[model samples]
Target: MNRQAQAVILLLLGGAVLRASVTDQYLNYVKPGLRGFLIAAAVLLLLTGAAALWQGMRTGSPAPDGHDHDHDHEHGHADDEDGHGHHSPRVAWLLLLPALGLLLVAPPALGSYAAGRTGTALTAPSDFAPLPAGDPVRIGLLDYASRAIFDQGRSLGDRRVQLTGFVMPGPDGTTILTRMIVSCCAADARPIKVALGGDLPPGIAGDPNEEQWFEVVGVYDARTVKDPVNAESIPYLRVVEAKAVATPAEQYES
Candidate 1:
C-alpha cells in the first residue's frame, strides 16, 4: 500500500460515515445522538486523507542534498516495520470492507432473528408512575413487563394498553410482541417481550413468524409464571385488538 491507497481508504471510510449520518441510517446501528460525532469524525478523516494525498503529490522539487536524507535512510527499516512503509500492513486494507458493505449491501437493521436468539429481562424505572390518561394507554413493552412482574400489575389495573413492536414466534406456537433495548448499538441490543394470548387480529394471524410490526390494544392478563427460557416472570397480555403498523424509523428502544 502506498500513500494514495491509504488516502483512498481514509476517504472511503469518511464518506461512509458521513452518508450514514446524513441519511439517518445511523439510527439503525446506533443512537441518534451519535450523529454529530459521526459527522465530525468523517470530516476529520476526510481532511487527513486529503492532507496525505497533497503531501504525496508534492514531488515538484527534489530534497536538498543533506544529512536529512541519510537520517531517513538509517531509520527507513525501523519505519517499515512500524507502519510507515511504502507497503502498509495488509490488515489496514480490510478497513475498507465495512465501507464496501455499507455502500453495496446496506444491511437491514437487526430484526426478529436477533430477538428470537436472545433471552430478555424487563427494565423498570426506579420510580414507577401511573399511566397517563388515555383510552388505550400507550406504554413501552419493557415498562409494561416490569409493572406486570414487579408491581403485580397494580399500575396496569384494568387499563387497556397499547404497545408496538415486531413479532417473535414462541416455541408454543404463539407470537410475542418484542422490542430490542439498546444502550449503545445493535451489538448490545437485548430483547424484551410480552406473550400475546387470546385471539390475534386478522393481519398477524396468517403467519406467526412474519416479523411484522403491530400496534396492539390489550390488557394485562395478570397471570404470573416464571419464564422457562429467561427465568424471569413472563408478562402476558390478553389481546383485545391488534393492527399491522409500519416499522418505526428507529427500531430499537433506548
Candidate 2:
C-alpha cells in the first residue's frame, strides 16, 4: 500500500491504542501486573507504525531494483516468497483489522466470574482488632467474613446499612441469595453472601454468571447469621431489595 494509506491505517490504530491505554476497559480486563505489557505493546506498535509511515511516503524515492517499490509491507512480511515484489505499505494498513476487532468485540468485563476464588483477602489484618468506633458503616459480607475469620472483632449492633451484589446459589436453586464481591476491578470479585430483607425489584433476579450485575436493598440484622463459613466472625447485612441491572463499562471497572 502507499505511504498515505499506511499513514491512515496507522493513524486509526494509534487512536485505538491511545484509547485502550487511557481507558479502564482494556486495563481492567487484564490482571493487576499484566496491564503494563499491553501499554508497552501499544506504544511500540504506534512508534513502529509511525516509522513505517515515514518509509512508505519515501516510496516516491527511487529504489535500487528500478522497479516500482512496494511501500507498505503486508502484515510485516516485507517480501513475498521467492523474493517476489509485494504490495505497498498501504497493504500494511490491513493490520488495523485486528485492532478494529478488539475495539468492538472487547471481552465482557470480568463481572462475577470470580465467585469463591481464594487469594489475598482485601481486609487488612488490623481490621480484626476491636471494631473501630463508628456510628454505622456500609460494608460487604465478604469483608465482614474475612474480618470475622481473621481480623479483630467488631459489632454492627443495630446499625443502618446498605448492601449490593448478585443473586447467588441458595438452599434451593429457586431461592437465590444476592451478593457482590470486589476482586481487582470486579473482574474476579467474590460474592459477599448478603441477606435479603425486603421486596424484590424487576431487574434484580437470576442465575449468577461471569457478566451479570445486581444491586440489593437491606439492613444489617444481627440474627441473620446462619452461614457455616465465617458465620461467627463475619457480620451480616439484611437486604430488602434485589435488582438486576446492566452496568456501564466504567461502573464495572471498579
RMSDs, each prediction?
3.6, 6.8
lDDT score of residue 159 within candidate 2: 46
Q: What is candidate 2's lDDT per residue for 107-160, written digit by digit as tens?
A: 554433343332223355443434345434545545555543443234444444
TM-score of every candidate: 0.86, 0.54
lDDT for each candidate structure: 0.80, 0.50
- The whole-model C-alpha lDDT of candidate 1 against the native structure comes to 0.80
Query: lDDT by residue for model 1 over 109-160, one digit each (tens)?
Result: 8888887667876766676787999989898898889888888888899999
Clash numbers, per candidate: 0, 24
Residue 68 in model 2: lDDT: 46
Model 2 per-residue lDDT at 98: 62
Q: Can you list the residue pairs that collide in candidate 1? A: none
Relative to the unseen true structure, what is the C-alpha lDDT of residue 108 in candidate 2, on a scale of 0 to 100? Answer: 53
